[model samples]
Target: MASSHPNVVTLHRVFDSPTDPYVYIVLEYCPDGDLFSMVIDSERYLMPPEPYVQDRSRTDGCPVPESPEYVEERVKLDNLIKTVYDQILSAIEYCHSLGLYHRDIKPENILCSADGQRVYLADFGLATGERYSTDFGCGSSFYMSPECQDGAGRRLTQYSTAANDVWSLGIILITLVCARNPWKEAVLTDDTFREYAKNPDFLLDILPISRALNDVLKRVFCIDEEKRCTVSELRASIRGVPRLTASNYETWERLLQRGLLKASRPKEHAQVPVEKNTFSNPDTNSSPSPSPVHSPPNASWDYGPKQGKFGQGLGPFAPTSSDDSWRILEKGRPR
Candidate 1:
């Protein structure tokens, strides 16, 4: 069921292997491996050496850095994490809209681009069309929702697949930002998450992430499945923040291509930052200024990078629910 969505992995074609009784799928090539490796490797690489250490040697210890280099690295890392999270949420929303629930959502199942500009959700073997199924408890233990976990008798409890996916998303986001998993397994049963639940700000207190993200995470990892944020609601909560979307996908691709072409030429190097409006505030009625687009040297061949009519339009910043949500109702149907 793969499509041409930027966030979801693209599937070109499917065929059967004549030599064996297996079906083969042709998928996009992601040289950067999976999200799990990216998180762990980046942390180790970004970790500064010991006292008076100047070499860029890899170490087993993941020590936090406080130097200016660290500041720049952090900014880049945060932006990447935010982008990936937004894309994953959007992809999941799209999947649900099509009556599909990815029963398995974890780092190992996600693939990232080499340049770290994009991520694609992969491994849908456990995906199913039923949203409220209780027959099977499938998914990685560390990222499974409490309801989806096997009980004392190894019976699969009834659960909402959407909520279960949301739980996995929460775990992924926390891991990306903190560069570590807060709990080994069993989110509700884990002491770390229990403490954070008592004081929601505990996550912000530990990680140097934005309060906006902290609020989203708190809603995402709710103990009660009904209370946990849906993919649409989660998208709305972070709608105000700047992110890339399909609407402007072409614009970004062109900018990236141009930058890469320039970067290849010697002595041609520059960097520019794009700025967009924060249309999320409910009190504001003013039209937002145009979003800034730039081409920087770091925008290699594979890389580089709007708020609401405040959630009144489509895409990530689109409102959780509105009349416009039904605007394109029958237009996309093939009669």
Candidate 2:
């Protein structure tokens, strides 16, 4: 962890203890606590004035109020969400570049500095290599992806990817927007979670929670790998940055209905055989064949959206839309 990421908290020293059966790791601490604390605090401040009862179930005497000001306070709360989401996306993108998957992503794992400006991704104990068989199962039980758990509650073996990390990100987002767990009413299990995930009733025509934020989270938490918001797509969603012409979120809704990931599973799981280059005739006109076959100069990122191209910088966070409608939502802007 320390050797690969320059921005990550460095492991300056390690100590071996014969008295205990483990090696002690020295980590940097944030005295102000972690993102979990902030989330609890944020939730407290964001509790709904009244429960969002459905129209059918709502009583005649009482009605739901307009969406909270926090949702649109661009400068203060909205910008804060954008900044944290951006930083989180950057950290996850960095790990993906190194082929590392943070299987466990929850409020607790993200640490915030005293000023709350710096958010750090911590707790690598459940972190694992991306390209591995995943039925083995590793991650926070509550936030684990639907694909990870089994009837017996064990993680599946033939799985794990950058997509899983995104799944966790979606859950974190739920915590942020709803100010409470969205699936609180459902059973906390694999089947239960998937059932709810497959059908998160956004109350689209019902009004109330507002459409803009709904559009944003739906894209962020998409289940299908193809349709699921890629890192680049997600980075843009932060700050309500709209890259699409329409912001109603229908395309994402269709994604859930079409379920692109399942159809592409076979293609995604098909691994290429790695041939060993034990002995090659280097002098055998290695440069004679000018077929223009090329390899990337760096593993970090591809410069464009082409086949077989790679680039870490191509994230959802990048700016793609016109600035005319998009603005850095400030506190008073909506607050």
Candidate 3:
């Protein structure tokens, strides 16, 4: 089914090495690499003004126009996000049509073409045919849905895999535009996520995304699986958005002045306490490693156990920054 879809990476062949006891799978090449790299690159070059600067500008009255080069680059990036996201949605929609769900749908699983305009949804190791699954904590910590995390300690019997995929997609879209994850995980243990759970529109206060996109994300991130927007509905909503980034500078200025956008600026070198093995099921004190793959040279995994209300294991995790504990897991999966 994946091979039949143009937006999905085609699997060519599978083989086993008789000597090394290993299996090799060949997949289509994506020259520009995964969407994770694209997002990291965008973060370095396209991030919005610092929080302090925004505050100062607000107090000083009004804001200035963005530089011509910055505006041009932002437009290009927004277009790229829309195109790549639309392709991803189409690929997932196709998978759903076949009664298959890609349980893991982060940026790392999405590969890009030479020009970076085209994208192919890759990595189906976590894909499943079941409409509902008992496999809690089945995806990356950053992108997993609340119900999938079962963070409330309710021990949910099962969750809608399709809805879980949609929730992950919402996080991915926000990351594409803001170059940051709204929170590390969806559980109440994470402060950022806790605030979001309390206020469905919390993202509007922090992310630079437009109000139109926020409305769509609210539906996408709905805690109720049955109430969550479907992939097709999400695709249509995103298409109708005029722009992904905030357009009303004056409104943003006012919000900043009133301290409503206080969380908009990330703390510098702040050590945020994170629950280890928060992804693991509370019922069973076991942490399941997603998959073993090489880590990037610049990154390292920390598997040390840290005691927290959620669990006793810290991570087989890579921390993106001291301030934001967003983990990009198993990015080097063979393809």
Candidate 4:
């Protein structure tokens, strides 16, 4: 289901050996590695990598080279951060539309393309569907939400996975913009997050990010799940960035849907011999060629049409129609 979203790592195919208990899941290979490396690089340079930079020529539909100009680099870097954030939120919103939620959303699980134009949300092993519910904590401590943390050995209370994901997104945004984590962990008991939760202006004092972005972060890190912005709301909040347009999102969505349709089609069957112990090896490689597998009903995994909000046509968040609508929403937000 997630493979259909361009911001998600594609799952080429999954094959199981009848002779062994192991299953082989083929996935897309990203040349640029994961977002953790990108975060480190951003910190080193205090900006986005050259490949990901967006200069003014970006508005004229041209890619700019890595410039020696510092002011130009900083402007490009800010646009790049907003662009990445838009995709991240879109990926999460798409997952929610599928009734799925990613429990782990830290930088380590996010992958950037070699050219750095694309970022994918990877590592769904910790993700869960809406049907799941639990009081136990999960995911990395650094990005966990206040509710996900047990207060100094106290039992964790039941919490919404969707809301927990929003908290992680908040942490990720801070890491991307500030090039450093605001807190070691997000827990009400932790002095860092607790102070921020009480007064989010603390973020602005440390980092010189815009008030618009800070407002978004404050709602994302809100201690009360009821107050935290939903993925839909997050999309609306970030969509108002002047340089980050909606067309990029619509283009990726259309391309991903086409790819998903191709991948979802049932494949032709073929057999290849494999040794018994080979399945036990973690690094074992399979044939590069595609093979046939049973494709589930499109209704079960399809997320585009049913999950849209406005109407049957991409819902309320549809890129074409909702761009201006979202702009109006931004006007109503607190400064």
Q: How many clashes in each structure?
A: 1, 29, 0, 5
Range of the 10 consecutive residues with the lowest summed lDDT in candidate 3? 294-303
Indicate which candidate wins on TM-score: 3
Candidate 2, residues 27-129: lDDT per residue as tens digits? 7766656665665543321332222221223222112332456234323544566677677788888888877877877777777774666777887776777
RMSD of 4: 23.2
TM-score of 4: 0.61
- Misplaced by over 4 Å in model 3 are 15-23, 42-60, 64-73, 151-155, 248-335
User: What would the per-residue lDDT of candidate 3 be over residues 259-296, giving only the tens digit for each residue?
Assistant: 54434222444332222323332345554333222111
lDDT of each: 0.56, 0.46, 0.66, 0.58
In candidate 1, the residue pairs with backbone N, CA or C atoms under 3 Å apart (3 or more residues apart, or in different chains) clash, namely 311-319
Model 1, span 1-335: residue lDDT tens: 64666778889889976898989889989888877667555442122211211112322211123357645555565566667778888889889889889987877688888555678988887898997987545776557776776431234457889888988888787666544444445444555555665777665433334556767778987767778999888877765644221112222334344443232221223222322223123445454342222222221111100111223321122221112232133123232
- lDDT winner among the candidates? 3
Per-residue lDDT of candidate 4, residues 1-335 (tens digit): 88988899999999998998999999888888777666554332244222212123223212234345744666676677778878899899899888898988877788988555579999997788853357446776667777777643345557788888888888787666544456656666556566676777666433335556767777887777767899888878876744321122222233344453222211134332221221121223343232221111111111111111211222111121112343244335342
Off by over 4 Å in 4: 42-45, 48-71, 151-156, 241-335
In candidate 4, where is summed lDDT lowest over 10 consecutive residues? 299-308
lDDT of 1 at 286: 55
